[model samples]
Target chain A: MDRKNIKGFLEFVYDFYKSMKAHEITLVYEGEITHQITKAFTSLTESNMAKEEESNSVQKKVFHVMVECLQNISKHADSFGSDDFLFAGRGIFMVSRGDLEYHVTTGNVIENSKIEELSKILDHINSLDKEGLKQLYKTQMREGRLSEKGGAGLGFIDIARKTGRKLEYHFLPIDEDTHFFVLTSTISRNE
Target chain B: METIKIMGTDDTPTVILDAQNEIFEISGRSLPEDVTAFYDPILQWLDEYSSSPNPKTIFTFKLVYFNTASSKLLLDILMKLEQLHEAGNNVVVHWYYPEDDEDMQEAGEEYADIVDVPFEQIGYTLS
Candidate 1:
């Protein structure tokens, strides 16, 4: 609240933004993931990619993955238990372009109780080959029931199949009862 | 029955089902937030169309992008068309993709693989 403290905080924020820019992140959004936000984000991202002269195919893949990631946060993000001031469904999402691939990253706080199930699912998906993932996607599509949140339990598998890459995920414990879940998926420019 | 026509939006596809003209088409992006709400009427229309389909029902898909939820509904629509075909109706699906988009072509192929109906993969450039 004091002048020197405010200066230090401003410098910290500047440093964070600088680091993100250095990584070639074209977009960085951190806040509540509302439906309006999702719609606007995808539209902005598509136009941004178009200006970059990315191929149509790659842009489609990036947009699809972005939708899934943003929706995942909106539907499943948990409130931080002790941090009551933080809004529910708050999450961080970013899209960065690398030399050969575009990386989509998202982070949200989740209940610690959900970590085991989430980890198991991620591990199972990561263990599959491309063919295996395709098979899984088809089978799930045919038989999986839609969740109350409208997910068909196929979002992750579809992402894996589209990217043809292992999904990278991590769970960082924020407290005894909550953890922040981060997911990263890459779409190869050559593909 | 009257034709069913729904205009496309940012998150929903344009649907044109004309029994009298024997033409059916779906175009644009389909990542609707409420997949069930957006697709229920289309499914119901298909059910009604199956009872009295045209001699040759040509279904065309020119989708730029769709999400996982829409993917499920798409398969459902295709399966309905397959049923119509199985019941001795002439059904053909024309799937169009941008010339540079191999992924869309592959998506059409995947749908073609799953159903017994005839499929045509068409690629065109946007001018």
Candidate 2:
């Protein structure tokens, strides 16, 4: 291989390893986000989190957020047309443990047309305080109809409620018709 | 009516609806991949029980965790119980949460506020 290509590959590996060590990342999965994969990810996370000396409440919060994040990938990830990637839904999921918090992050591809709706939802969620989020969650639960995919449209709201933190998200343009979406939520170690 | 008992799975909750014993309980995690398919049977059982509910029906929810999709079905279940209670049957809901989980407790209160059914909030430490 060319010297530049070799250098780039080595740099990618080095950066990945550095980040894993620096962030204390417990788990990382980057592949098709199928139902089976989600289950396996969760079970693995449950065992890993159990190993840590954390309260049951904190463990539950992290687990719940992780589940929602993985489900989002499975439900929304758009298929890439390349034959090399034949998975049903492709995404990246990771969990990192900080000194006083746990962070869950996920990324997936979505149609560009969905960007506006998703941006609005995230903006609304970011605007709300804890009480506002709770109220909105209840209202959505009582009045909102389930989506065609069977989601109650309360995933983001529930995440906000559970974490009591603003959701960090971004949409990067991938093509004229598609964009990559990334979302992150954090759970504090303290009650 | 016949008892509707469903064993819990890694992704779904355990459900026991015994009309004879007057015990209705759903406990454990509930985030099934196919929420509609998972909850359809329970809803049908509730529909059947509505016709001839017991004198006093106490429905208990001891869910450790549930997804957003499952939340919709939970509301449907609570609404059904509300209808049953309004029809002059004595129906009450007991929502149990981990002692420190204010989120679940608030969820119970939200459901109680939306539905006319009486709800009792119970907090217990998980063993």
Candidate 3:
């Protein structure tokens, strides 16, 4: 069937993950992406046993960041229904690993028209190192609007800064109306 | 002028805004299901506090985390305090944040810029 490539892709992914030594594993989720937002976060927390040993300070910060990031996806993603405000998706979320870090990846469906804006924001945030992110975070937090449901578009930037990792992204065109946006970030516990 | 004390929840912060005492404190996390309900009374109390100026008003915000809506309401609250200060009332914001947390500290600094009151950033030793 013409689905061979998709099947192959799945096989490769399976083999790749089977080779890794992940401390925690989460059930793969499919279908409407919004419901998976919380699942993605839970997966991260579940997999990272080190998370428990983490200092209360780190735990609090990570918890805060997790909530903010999940909300961000919900705010930006395309969805249908009154409960849409409470959930997000049309995306995929998974956690994988490297040698010394855990990776969190979330993919969501977005309007193709907004790709340029999203790219610009990602590039701008990526360009800023720690200090620059701090300055930007402060600037946005102070002057940013509060009445809105989303942060001053600073949530993702804040995430990149806090994680101390470059945000990795991919845009796969799903169709004329929508595009799949992927965001991959790593949180490093080893310094 | 009323006293409202809502203890901090897993999702929201403790809100202690006493109109009579002129002590406004919001501490802990803030990501309430319905932010309007949680903030409505606090906003109303601030209105009263502004009307009959207290000799000294201390606004303390020690939030571990707050979402966007809470952030806006925070600005509204700060602006009210600024008006109080402008009206020749003694208003001071003693903002405290965890020492290593640049986000919270910067948030305090941002508020300091917009409001005319004296804003101090106090870093507590991590406990």
Candidate 4:
């Protein structure tokens, strides 16, 4: 290995580590978001949060959103190419702790055609207050049919209701038929 | 009717639906990946129990946390119990939560609002 190239790579690694420490990124994973992965991640976060002496409500809120986001990726992520079929269910999940708050962010590949419907659901959720979100949640549960993936379309709404804020998201174009979707939800450290 | 007793795990709740022994409750956290598969048998058992349900039935939900997927199935469970109540069986749903976890109580209240059954909210300190 070239000494100069190795030095440059080490510098980059050092910068990344510092950035992660600055943000208090406690957990991060980037790979196929399978059911087993979701279980393990949430369990790990639960104990970690407990170790930090976080309040019960804050831990639950973060835990709940993490599950929804992780499962959201597993249920909805799509493959980028035939050669990378495993990437079909791949995504990135991270948890960062800041003063008085914690944030859970997830990113996954989604079909461009599916963007409109998903955005509509998110936008509708954004327009609602806590009471309205609760109504939407109950109505969806009572009347909406579960998708083949076994979701009653309650993930986004539930997250919104729990967080009591609009979902922060972005859809970056990747190709003519696919885009990368990122979602972040914030929870206060104290109730 | 045979009782259904499934032990809890890290991701699923402990379910005990015993009629002969007069103990019926589901407790613990729930975020099962295939929520339908986990709940199908419980719904089906409630269906069977509906046919010859005891005269007085008390179903307790001691869930600490559940995901949106499990939330949907929860309504199905409550609806099943409502059916039993409608069929002239006296039914009461005892909803338990950690004293500090009011969200679980609110969850129970939402289900109570949606379904027409007597629901009693009980809170216990976390152990």
Q: Which stretches of candidate 4 lie over 4 Å from their true place?
A: A1-5, A83-86
Query: lDDT per residue, candidate 1, B25-79, as tens digits?
Result: 9999998878898888888999998997877888999998888888888888999
TM-score of each: 0.92, 0.92, 0.77, 0.95
DockQ of 4: 0.86
Off by over 4 Å in 1: A81-87
How do the residues A103-177 of candidate 3 rate in per-residue lDDT, one tens digit apiece?
566677787778999899899999998888877866676667644554456677667876877788899887776
Clash pairs for candidate 2 = none
Global fold similarity of model 1 (TM-score): 0.92
- Name the 10 consecutive residues with the lowest summed lDDT in model 2 chain A: A80-89
- Would you give me the overall lDDT of model 1? 0.88
Candidate 3 ranges beyond 4 A from true positions? A1-52, A56-61, A80-90, A96-99, A146-151, B34-37, B99-103, B125-127
Q: lDDT, candidate 1, residue A62?
A: 91
Judged by DockQ cut-offs, the docking class of candidate 3 is: acceptable
Q: Write the per-residue lDDT of candidate 2 for residues A69-140, one digit (tens) a residue.
A: 887887778776667855546799989888889999998888888889999999999999988997898889
Top candidate, metric DockQ: 4
In angstroms, how far off is A85's CA in candidate 3? 17
Specify the highest-TM-score model's number: 4
Task: Write the number of the candidate with greater DockQ, choosing between 2 and 4.
Answer: 4
Give per-residue lDDT, candidate 1, residue A23. 98
Tens-place lDDT per residue, model 1, A47-95, is 9889989887788889889999998988789886454575677899999
DockQ of prediction 1: 0.65
